[model samples]
Target: MPDMPTVSLNKAAPPPLPPTYQDPQLLPEPRRCDTGAGIVWIRKAFDMFKQNIGIWLGITVAMFAIMMVLTIVPLFGILSGLVVILFIGSFMQAAAIQERGERLKFEYLFSAFSTHLKPLLILTLLYMVSIAVFFILTFWGMHLLSVSNFLEARVALDSVGVSSSKQWIVMLYMLIAVLPMILLSMAFWFAPALIVLHDMAAMTAVKKSLQACLKNWLAFLIFGVVGGLLSIVLMVFTLGFGFLLVMPMMLLVYYTSYRDIWTDQPLSIDA
Candidate 1:
């Protein structure tokens, strides 16, 4: 018989290693960026979106679908905040992967659930509590204002002509009520990314995020104005369909901003 060729069994090659930066590191204090950096962050995010448009769209749609489902189901809507936190962390992870030249996959959307779920959930709970406190205080303050207004109006009716509707009181109340929630949002703006990327504790991450926002308030103001205008334009031109693109881009912007402010090594636009 002809000599049989000897077959050698070789083990499958090990899977490629993830990007080294994925490992948690001790991040420095957030940097204060120039106002122009806001526009740069948005442009970089758009570049990231263009690099993997299809995947970005898919992730956005998936997230929207999940949120809708949660909203429609009774009592389950409460979970929407938790879902948002998870997705935020996942988006940060995806951004990191893309920054390293890796192709972003849809599977990355759920990666946070495995690695950072607990802390993310804690963040969500804290947000919910803050919202609840806001609503309670708003109602209580409104009631007190109404009573005071009523008493003052009666006094005015007896004295000079009837006072105007006291609309200023309502305006003042609204301003006061909104301020705390704005601060709450600032505290949360970068907390998820800090927890996901730097492995910071929940409270510590919230503190850092707030400090970062205050440190770079000018940049954030610019970012908010530009992003708000873009959102309005998209909604007007696309009749709301543009949210399919805007949603993902918003997450990418967040990731880019976090990287720019929190890390010594920020992602380049070209990257």
Candidate 2:
């Protein structure tokens, strides 16, 4: 009988290509969008708002009521930041659910609490710290400017009919000082969505959010300008009550922008 073909088991089949290595912590690289993409974000957000107007209004009312209650309780108002973070995450989650063709539910407003409470809280803490640092630095810088002869120069200029009031100078200083805070806001803009959707840590989420915003600064600039103008119009036409509507729409825009920049599929609403 032909010698049984010698079967060589010497080589374990090369370890099945290590199951496609996937990093659980991997995050998407933020995309740089065209400047006009800002307007597109608003349009998409508006479409989402139209689809769930009733639920959106209800969530807005609930948010206002809760925030009012928190504000009424002495010292508890500080928790408002945490509440806002949770609400933001919930809004992102709701948008995702709605994108799946499901009807929006009021309960979505509180859903983040169960799944992402800790990270949301951490975000709030970081927010508070940022505010504190802003104030501290602003005041300290003002003090330095005040003592550095800047005030004297202003006075001399005023005396020369330059019409520079100390109040105006301070206002200008404050406006200039707020530039950094605006950047900080950009850093934090997408953090809640990142935390809720990606399960990213607070710090990591903030860093990524900032990078995303910086990469799309032109788009954000357009967004800011258009949003500001729209807000003014809404406020004027509706006697400030428009904020209730504006607030929800703004949150939708936040979610839409996050989806646009970080995910392969952006949220869409049917015409």
Candidate 3:
């Protein structure tokens, strides 16, 4: 049996990393904590972000502009536009993780297209399926409740009479709505993390994502709720400029929190 490797957080992270990375280098070989400054090397990787937010932001905007163009710019076919966008986004994410000088450009977004397209698409579809399944299950449950409480409720509305039947159905619908939120949220909990950190088929990533969430439901929920609320506030208050800050913070938080699995050691970073 291979030795169970020990993970030491905040240790040696690979060099030439981008500045926006506030995480300690997480090596797959021997998993490590996301914080890079304890029992390990203590260096912040976000120098690029702080020093060049303008240029980086411009690049991101350009990429978004290209996406807008594709909607109108007729291509050989829909496939052409989709393929281009997918490559663009994936490459951008992956490239952001590459060495400093080459990090966070519109060009980076297209990096993963040629080599990592199929797996990335598969993972994305798996997340979509999880979403679809959540809705389907909730809808079915609601339909059943509605049937029992509303129209055709008690076939003979005259004889199978019950007081406040509509109210009862409404309660049931609420319960149904809440049920999937609790149950299915776990399935897609770490989907984005899995997609970015590992390469696998969509179905497999979905399975793993669910497993990861179930394994650490409490922690994930806490993380999700806090992040979600912050996002909502940002959207409302700043009219969305808040996304620039919120996005990076949540991304790092998700990445850090997700390291919970596949390693024993823990390192904490403040949100």
Candidate 4:
């Protein structure tokens, strides 16, 4: 008997993959927010702040000190912004824990350092790069303005109480500096939460953040305006010590906004 010929099957080759890397996509749309949601965010933040003011204050101070130290380090100093990213998750965790009726502890602020280090560090680098670009463009614009004598008008608006050339320079610098920072802030606003809480990649989280903000720009504008005014009033009335209390509340507000805008279900307010 002749041996049967062995059968050879040619398996279909896997399709070639695309060369470009695609960013992680977010939900089709963000949760809808109303104008009143902005105020509600501040209120909820205050509630969270009240739950653990001491712990919150301590965490803030410690983080501030850490940031200062990082900024002073020789080579790593430029990455100090990245250092701040390391703690953003911790702060959000602390807030979430408090919302869950748990006692806030200082250790909560360091929790993300253990698990989310890589993405957070990458985010920090991107954040730092954005800031660097912002400043570079800001200074360059100012230089161009100065060199071109663009602002050399004899009459000053004096609307914001500027009278002298020195004042004009300072005011002009500030005006020029604000636009880029505003853009950068909006773009990165939700990136930390997405990266830390939702496990998104750095660039993907950034795109989601920007998308979420763009989808709810009006609410954000209201929040920024009203929140800023209220914060100023609080600080002024309390001779600036109020800022310590308000600072944590503001961060919580930011986190709350992220939750409200990004989460699908109705936000649960801890009783």
For each candidate in turn, the TM-score is 0.82, 0.80, 0.57, 0.74
Give the clashing pairs for model 4: none
Q: Alpha carbon lDDT of residue 108, candidate 3?
A: 53
The TM-score, computed over Cα atoms with residue i paired to residue i, of candidate 4 is 0.74
Q: In candidate 4, how many Å is residue 197 off?
A: 0.5
Instruction: Name the regions of candidate 2 deviating beyond 4 angstroms.
Output: 1-27, 149-172, 267-271
Q: Residue 224: error of model 1 in Å? A: 1.0
Query: Residue 150 CA error for candidate 2 (Å)?
Result: 1.2
Candidate 4: which stretches are off by over 4 Å?
1-27, 69-79, 101-103, 145-176, 268-271
Model 3 spans > 4 angstroms off:
1-52, 55-104, 149-171, 181-185, 260-271
Model 4 over residues 206-269: C-alpha lDDT tens digits?
8888878877888888889999999899889999988788778888876788768886533434
Q: What lDDT does each candidate get?
A: 0.84, 0.84, 0.52, 0.77
Residues 110-206, candidate 3: write the lDDT tens digits.
Answer: 6666656776666556545666787888788667656564655444444656554656556656876886776665564445445554554556655
RMSD of each: 8.9, 10.5, 12.6, 14.9
Residue 89 in model 4: lDDT: 78
